[model samples]
Target: MNFAIRALRKNEQRVAVLFIMTIYPNKVSASTSPFAFIKDYSGIPREQEILFSTHTVFRVGKIKPTFNYNRLCEVHLTLTDDNDPQLAALTHRMRQELCGSTGWHRLGHLMLKVGEYNQAEELYNELLKKASTDSEKAHIYHQLGCVKDEEGEYKDAALFYEKSLEISRKTLPEDDPSLAAIYTNIGGVYHNVGDYSKALEFYEKARQIKEKALTPNDPSCATSYNNIGSAYYHMLEYIKAVEFYENALEIEEKTLPQNHPLLATSYCNMGSVYKDMGDYLKALEFYEKALKISEKALPPNHPDLATFYGNMGQVYHNISDYPKALEFFKKAHQIKEKALSSNHPSWAAFYNNIGSVYEDMGHYPEALKFYEKALETSEKSLPSNHPELANSYGNIDLATSYGNIGLVYNSMGDYSKALEFYEKGLEITKQASPPNYRGLAASYGNIGLLYRHIGDYSKALEFYDKALKIKEKDLPLDDSDLATSYKDIGSVYHDMGDYIAALEALQNAFQIQQQTLDENDFALSPTYCCFGKIYRGLKDYSRALHYFEKCYTIVQQVLSEKDPALAIIYNNIGDIYRLMGDYETALSFHQKALNIQENVECNPLDCATTYTSYGETYREMKDYSTALIYLQKGLHIREKKLPKHHPDLAVIYHNLAKLYLATQQYNIAMENIQQAMDIAQEKLPLNHQHLLDYRETFEKI
Candidate 1:
């Protein structure tokens, strides 16, 4: 066996000599034993042992024929197997002696690798008690820091790493590998604590040291790149994150094996960057590559495989492939449920992901069930005010649970219940340390949506602006969340008859969506619809049809045929046709919308809106009897289902008045016009074009 002493500093040699002295105090004299090698190397006055040869060289220069403690030296000890009882006995004794220090260090490292953090801490702490020098104590402290890091005690881990770093700076050279490693460890602690700026500071320091001291493709240098990428990723700097991730991947591919776990991590990190950038196809490509490597490198039940499956799930969900998303999510959940403890935060995260998929699919009951499960798991696993429960980027897990429940209630047309849950989420988000702006934005947006549905445009705009302000500050320019805020604000403007502001906000959202999202992404559908409606309000029929067609094409590609969203686009297209004097084409499109509504279990409000559009198309064609029938059908449903002051009801009544006027039923026409005028006066702005038009129609009736 040959033991090579490599990368040892000048002071390290003195420490090693002291350690040898402590282990073999009286046995330092020349003898035919392994301990004899230490005596020859230490420059003590002793004769050479006949059984062994020694090689020692001073690093700086040849020393005088005298003991000089200042000179740095390299020592090589070689033991060869021989058919001799004395040699065997000496080898056995050497193993037993070295086991006290080296064995404990190796065992502690193994414990840390296996996630036995408490055991690793105990072993490292025991080693600290026996550590005789600053170098030895630094190594022990570094190991203890690793144990704390693994246990998620980031503050304590950082303290231990700083202590190790302080000692290393004093005892080791400026560009020592140990100093680089300690800097990286401290950076990891800051990264885990959500301090991306602080994390980047330390990570840059580590990278500078590693670049100076290590080769370009060294694994340690790659780790610094990877850590820097992670910090950028958490900061939502996707382009910078991708750049650093590619750098790490370049080094990893050059040095690591094809199936190395580190290569999978590099690919996974790239996938996350693309995912956040709203590039679903690129995200999926990287995620699949990571999954392939993880499957090859890890066991079927490994947590890394679960992560890959979850990442794939997120990609599918983003692209609106509900079935595929559910399939991947369920696979990930199954693996995580079996691999992790029931109350583990990872299990909660998995459940939350599954719930989000269900929510996007409009399966509200299932969404609520999974969201509740996530909350239950979080309650068991996390402390009451755990920071992880409050996400800084916007969606706090605990607040998300409440907000998601509110969304389901809103979808179910239960406005009061939705308000209760949304406010609950809002209050929780406001209590977060530094306040979870992202969560606050989402809660405010939800409240805005509820208010919009209830026809309170002023309150809706207020909340929507609140969401927009937070999102503008927290999100990047092309972020999907920023697009959503703009979309909500635009929709409120449209409802308030502020067509110019609506067009401006919708165009802003469209520009962002075009930059960041796929053409067929479901999130872009609403932006398209809003553009269509704004153009239609401006009487730009050609532009209205163009946007409505875009919305229709996207929904056709992404949604099922029976989706109620299809009916909305159809109705908008019908309205455009009516405005262009193509009444036959208008009625055909409205009937197509009505057919879908009648066939599917659609929302009654949607069915009523389609009926009103159909009535308007028939009245345009001078089909008074048919127009009255459709108008009455729509009015009956709206009167029963909608609030008396709903703007939609006002529009329906206006259509009924026009139908009655076409038939020369002057008294009934005047009565219906009066109702329309009353609702318009109550709900619309004084100078609104709809109110002016309604007043003219009332005088004619």
Candidate 2:
């Protein structure tokens, strides 16, 4: 410890830390001496030194600052012998994965495994120059292709893979297992470029070859199944994706060691599929299993471990556990920063996820900052023509980044800026080769949402229909994405004063949800909420309450009690009670809503809804003074958050007009009613229910 501290004191450039390592070696292992004490041969005989073997593995333990010095730390390490189960299993799997005919080949494979892509490429290229056989040249080409693939040069990867395939075909049998590996590589290149159909073709070819050439439970076959599953996942064919993923998992569980890293990949793949299916609990189960195995089989800062963390974060994000989600996201980012380059395409995903959590929390400026960081990272790391940035989810292309920014702008009430970014994203999606239908659908849906927010019901319907048409043509009938399209169209129709059309579209969405999701799935909550709103518009109080309660039940099952989304449901239920003339019950629910909305970070407009609901209930009970206070509070938030002519603003105006008229303040009521009339005349359809209500209130005044 004194020797290490003395050495650190000689560096004058900056503060340098000294790591005093305490190694606990396993003396019971007789196979090898992992360390040797060499005091006799030391130049400084008084300072005894111990030398450890090059390949000795250590499990890191406690690391803490010591000796009251901020820079100095004590690190505890346990040296692993051959008897260590985790080390033994990881070594065994790694040897199998990196199997090669020569030490040089194994060295090249190791370089690739440790993410030394440039070194691996140079080694393979030099080896290619000296290759004596066609098989040797083919293997070297395939390795080079892997290097390019890891470096995000997909076109070069495809070329190298094709070269290897061409040579292998001429030299080897048609059913060679080696050829299947090449085919899978080619499929991966296609997958990275967002051409799922082409990727599927190559993946299927690899699967067929593997099945014919290998045993029924061969681990190689599992790789093919996983590749096929990933393609289906990208294509939005969740059923097929699950089937293939389970097939891969079955083979892996049967053949691979429990703690093998490949098993972690299978588990993560299954988790991703479940997460997208809206089965968050199941997703977390699989992600935990994957994380446990990865912790045992890989280094602490391995990129694969980061992927597991990212998967766990995604599940928490879907369930609206923002703090837990952010915690997991930052953990993943810490690992990624250690394992990957700063501008690596993978960084975009971490940035995007954290941005999404902020967006949902209604922190638009913070969300936009992270979204722009994602865009910058993506542009720096990915090719111009690359459809998706290709993260753990294999989603979030450059187009998605633009759309994310647009969404934040839309939430911030900068509609023109939102539309500009949305249009840019749409154009990029349109230009994607082989036509990324799924991405196109999402872009169209975003634009549609922007239009709906601006009260352009006809324009919203146009874009939503375009999105729905593409989904219908490309996605399975029971796909959750298809259900989302139905929900969007339904919401627009509900806004356009077409109750029958709204009910029909919502029913279509519900049917799809029933086919694909559990009854209590969080995805079904929004559909139920939409159904409740439509019934409320029709004055069917009982049916409206029934749907609202169903929605609330699902939300309670999925989200935390204090989640901002829960506050919205509370406000909805309160308004339903008020409509049914149960003022006390309505006030109780409104209080519950305010308890959450006032304390949490959420859209000011959502908080305004609760205030307005309280005002309506109080006015009905003839509490005019309290009603005015709540109405003014709601009016202030709406005016600040929404555009001057927004239809939602008109609703608040009409509510205030009713409260003022009930108190016989005719002049003040007339002013509020005229403001509502002006907004409705400019923004809403003449026959819209809100406009009709405004007219009725005008007559009363």
Best of the candidates, TM-score? 2
Q: Estimated TM-score per prediction?
A: 0.70, 0.93
TM-score of 1: 0.70
Question: Candidate 1, after superposition: displacement of residue 99 in Å?
Answer: 18
For 1-701, candidate 1 gives per-residue lDDT tens digits of 01212323423643222111122334333443433345555554364423233422111212232134333333432233233344444335333423225777877876664345667788888889988999889888888888777655555677789899898899788777668878888878767655677779989998998898888888778888899999988877777888899999998888666666678888999999888776667788899889887775555666667888999988877766667888988788777765566765456667778888776655668888987887776566445454441233223556777777787777666778889989988997897654567778889999999888777888999999999999899888877788888888888888888899999998898898888667766566777788889999899999989989988987787556766678888999999999999988888888889888888656677788888888888888888888888888988988876667777788877887877887899888888888888888887788777788889888888
Error of 2 at 551 (Å): 2.0
C-alpha positional error of residue 470 in candidate 1 after TM-score superposition, expressed in Å: 4.0
Q: Give the TM-score of candidate 2.
A: 0.93
lDDT scores in order = 0.75, 0.85
Query: What 10-residue stretch in candidate 2 is worst by lDDT?
Result: 386-395
Deviation (Å) of 236 in candidate 2: 1.3
Worst 10 residues of 1 by lDDT: 57-66
